[model samples]
Target: MALVLPFEPNEPSIEALVALVKADMERVNATILARTGSDVAMIPEVANHLISSGGKRLRPMLTLACASLSGYRGDGHVKLAASVEFMHTATLLHDDVVDESDMRRGKLAARKLWGNEASVLVGDFLLGQAFKMMVEVGSMTCLDILATAACVIAEGEVMQLAAAKNTATSEDDYLAVIRGKTAELFAAACEVGAVLGQRPKAEQAACRSYGMNLGIAFQLVDDALDYGGSQAKLGKNVGDDFREGKITLPVLLAFRRGDASERAFWQRCLEKGEGNDADLDQAIGLMTRHRAIADTVERARHYGAIAKDALALFPNGQAKDALMEAVDFCLSRAH
Candidate 1:
């Protein structure tokens, strides 16, 4: 018989998958706290501020779930999961700095409280610690996967910088940006679990594919949500991306499909960076007319289906089911 863990409902919740990995996650959490500590008062203070804040820890949980699903029975998965979280946190600190974002997780951004210099340095400190943890895990293959992902994520940021405020940014350009900044880590997080679990090369590739597609879906939904999602859940204002002049997929589609006068409106607000509250309202209206939100969600569902299919080799069990449900959860957030 295949391995089967417990869940209360027929349909699994992401919370249920989280529960299934509670034991491993406990170790990962401990590892995170221990690694983030520092003798310098400010390093620990700034790092812990974001680490302790109520982030969902989903990426790390993916690490743990993939390990368990592939029959991992050792402690290496714990350290690897912690490394994934550190990578994510480091990126968040740096991203907020780059985006000049005002809020995070419904609170004052660490940069706001501690200043930009502190935030960037703290982010660097987290990356250093994350690398140290990866080295200690003693899996060069895992280390190589994560290190490459880090580089790709940086490249993605640079790509976004190049594309920013360019109304002509193509859908392929946007895909490349998100694939690096968002999906690469998700891919690394799941791929490393297979490595630690001693899964075959094909299984490892499958895990990576699953994570990559799911991450794409997740990001697409986020793009939609930024224009239409509830701020209470998002911890930021609706149209934050628009205010920043980001050329997300929704805007890309609407820009391409709109009339000449509509293109001029986009040029005035996004291309010229003259956005105001009323301008954002108009942008949302334009997206609505062009069916950008619905289309984006439709694209997300397409990727979500690919993510589901990627897990076909895995047996019906708690981890597999949870991971499958996770694909649904990523898409559902837009609703």
Candidate 2:
């Protein structure tokens, strides 16, 4: 059940982009470790566990990449990148708690390692540290963008909670949720980079658009993979979304395609949150019958293409090329 990409993977441009992202991630983590200090030994342990779990660090890398592409050669980019990563890691810690997830990136979650109390505390600490880093930059604009993004992210989580196991959720509703939970931070990441680079307003807007579209595409692919991906590759069990009664794009599309009885099945599972194996299988059957999975993949690709288009404003260079490669990598990820 490995998640398959729509393309081959031999692009040198993509390779270079990944290398740059990896290098920046190393630097970001080192900076975080230095800042956390030894007094809070548990802080380092928890943070390292999350960091070592092997995420793409795409958000923070976007910050660095966007800054570099804007011709920034200052140390501020490093702090900004680390701030983005911290914010992302904080969200992950909180999300795992909310989702009651046992695994992330194929390892035990922070809450699983420590208690929920520790996880929540450390998550708050990370958030505060992120804000402190923002203050150090002394950019009111950057702080304002991040603060707004954080608020939107929290609201998105609440919206998702309200939508959970509720078949009445519309596509628009879904878009709103992901925009807050996923895209807002991404937008802030790139926007912060542009701000750090002191780019023009139009260029900053373009970077924001790129980040937003990329985030949407990234999350759409993630949701699609829940149904189409291998447990090993996804680092989670197949059908976990259904089991948890989370209504995602595939389920929503399937509901739209279902007959009365099939709709009744959805009601029992998604609306009522009472799904068993039979119901789960029936839901999968209905989704496949209507090509919901394929439709979702196509939609994700559409957004991915939009993300690439947003980068068209920039001239061709290593950083710009790498940004495009990162977009392709998002579309081609098998995990």
- Which candidate comes out best when scored by lDDT? 1
lDDT of 2 by residue, 1-335 (tens): 99987998584335666676676667777888776554778887887788777776778889988888888877777788888888888999899899888888888988998978777878888888899888998889999999999999999999999988777689999989999999999999998888888999988988899999989988888887887788777777778788888989999999888888888888888777788878777777788889887788778888889888988888999888888887777777633
Q: Which ten residues in a row have the lowest lDDT in candidate 2?
A: 11-20
Name model 2 segments beyond 4 Å from true.
1-14, 21-23
lDDT of every model, 2 decimals = 0.91, 0.84
Candidate 1: segments with Cα more than 4 A from true spot: 1-12
* Per-residue lDDT over 54-134 for candidate 1, one digit per residue giving the tens place of the 0 to 100 score: 888989999999999899998888998999999999999999999898888888889999999999999999999999999
Error of 1 at 239 (Å): 1.1
TM-score of each: 0.95, 0.92
Q: Which candidate leads the pack in TM-score?
A: 1
Worst 10 residues of 1 by lDDT: 7-16
